[model samples]
Target chain A: MACFLVPTTEAIVTTIATKIIEKKEKEAVSTELEQGVELSSLHRERFSVKLNRLNHLLWGGSLLLAFEHFWHGEIQPFFPFLTAAGNPADWAEALHEMSTVGVGMAVLVTCVWGVHTWVLDRIAQREGMAQHEEQARRAIRK
Target chain B: MTLLITILAAVVTSCIWYSSARARRLKTGVLCSMFWGASLMWLVDAVAEYIELGAAYFTPAAQDMLNDAFLGFSVIVLALTVWVVLLFVKDPDGVVRSALHNQRS
Candidate 1:
């Protein structure tokens, strides 16, 4: 299956940025910003470890399913020869077809994962910065 | 071919897991996990098929445990991903209001 997170993540970030962070950055919602997160106070290292483990397990898990599909006579059996583009009439033909598109699909998946991770990193940084600023402002107010 | 497939699956899974775990801790939700997990799954199977081109390389020791593990992981993670995403989309303001909002209340 296609990785759904690239678009989903982008959509989420875009919405949050446009409606929430952007307004704060522009000083358009100063009141809400003051009431929202005191960003820097977050302890994120613990969270990071949890996310990393989850990613590895899930990615591996996905591959395992695909393996099962072929091993158990799902896609691989039908394709037969492993060729690309058109469907094969037998297992031999399906095997041949697998060479071209399979690799490409793998690369596509890795790339999507990379991009999604990149966005997550950015989100973490943004949250950290916001928290820091909030803490500083509170300190000054005191 | 099976040996290579096993190796491919192990390496890719480890990398994805490590990277994604880091992302999850820092970011807000489970989007990265689902995307990364699904992508990695496809990659492992795709590579195995590609390498199986040489019948001589196929081995006898494929791990059946992998299937069970993956199935369990996918179901749990996807469910969590869906729940988290819906929560974020439906009430964008709630998360930022308080850390307690994030708790399983």
Candidate 2:
């Protein structure tokens, strides 16, 4: 009944991590600027941005699932929050579901995001290589 | 049955997202992830039910099946609503911005 909680937990962790990494990214960018690095050449997507994407996916899915659970009356706006948490037997079932379904969803979303990140990285690398080649050609012509 | 419906939606949305640039621009990937997550949850629930009920799991009451179908459709509708809101906020093509700019002028 509380399968959404797993991803919600993940979302919270990622959200905090995103904020921390974003601050670090800002500091790093400022330092690079102080070292005379061109901001235009700092075109790579920040890790925090990638983490934010995963956070978005997790939070969005968890929100919809939580809404669905509430719609089905599996969730309550009261103490314990989950209808299944009222009794020991049902609480055990809820835990089982959380361990299985909830964990499965969290893992699946992470795997998909991992693949998407890899693809994005590949695209960025190719574009960077192409830009370097173009600059080299212009230099030769000059 | 609900699991099947959600899985089907996830697969269809993923295919659309992969094949269409506009769908990607609109962030259909978000919808895909939602559907996929729900589908996996339901799949696990189904397996648990099957284990507990054996052959009876395959013979759910018609009313239960109907209710499950409605829940499945409702989940899809809710996901679409959320995705629409995201698109409006993002305004990928600057559609809302342009409309507002035109109105102001």
Candidate 3:
């Protein structure tokens, strides 16, 4: 019932990390610009972009799942928030579900995101290669 | 039932995202991931329940099925609401910004 909490926790951590990293990235960019160093893309996406994608996936999924849990009356607006908190037996079951279903979901989402980032990187690398080839061919013709 | 519904939503959103580059501006990928993640979570839940209940898992009560269907539909609505809010805030087309400017002028 409280399975969404796992991803919600992950999202919170990632959100904080994104904010910190984003600040650092902006500072780095400014320093590079001040040094008159030309920043090249190399067709590679920024780490922040990839992190944001993971953040989006985690946050959006957690939010929707939380809403669904609320709809099912598993969650309450009151203290404890979870219906399973009322009793020890139910609490134990909830914990079991959290460990199994919740953890599984969190891990699954992370794995999917990892694969997605890998694919994007591969695509970007291929694009960079093609651009390099095109430039080389143009230079030869010139 | 919720699993089925979410899987369908994920497939539909993914198809839209893949077919239309314009949809990327709307950030349909967020919706796609949300639905797909939910579907996967539900699938795991279903499997766990099957293990616990064995053959009885296949014969869920009618009321439970209805409840799941409602929950699935509600989840879809909530996801759409979130996506819409994001779109409005981002205003990728500058629609809101231009509207405000027009009004001021």
- Predictions in order: chain A TM-score: 0.41, 0.96, 0.93
Which is the better candidate, 1 or 2, if ranked by TM-score? 2
Which 10 residues in a row give candidate 2 chain A its minimum summed lDDT?
A35-44
Steric clashes per prediction = 41, 0, 0
Q: What is the lDDT of residue B2 in candidate 1?
A: 30
What fraction of correct interface contacts does each candidate retain? Answer: 0.27, 0.36, 0.54
For every prediction, compared with the true complex, DockQ reads 0.14, 0.36, 0.63
Candidate 1 docks at the CAPRI level of incorrect
Model 2 chain B weakest 10-residue run by lDDT: B37-46
Candidate 3: true interface contacts recovered = 0.54
| Tens-place lDDT digits, model 2, residues B25-89 | 98998888778766655665677678889999999899989988898788888888988998999
Q: How well is each residue in A27-106 modelled by candidate 1, as lDDT tens digits?
A: 63356467785543334443334334344434434444444444454534453322232443553444443444444444
How close is chain A of candidate 1 to the true chain A, as a TM-score?
A: 0.41
* Candidate ranking (DockQ, best to worst): 3, 2, 1
Off by over 4 Å in 3: B100-105
Best by TM-score: 3
In model 3, the Cα lDDT at residue A103 comes to 91
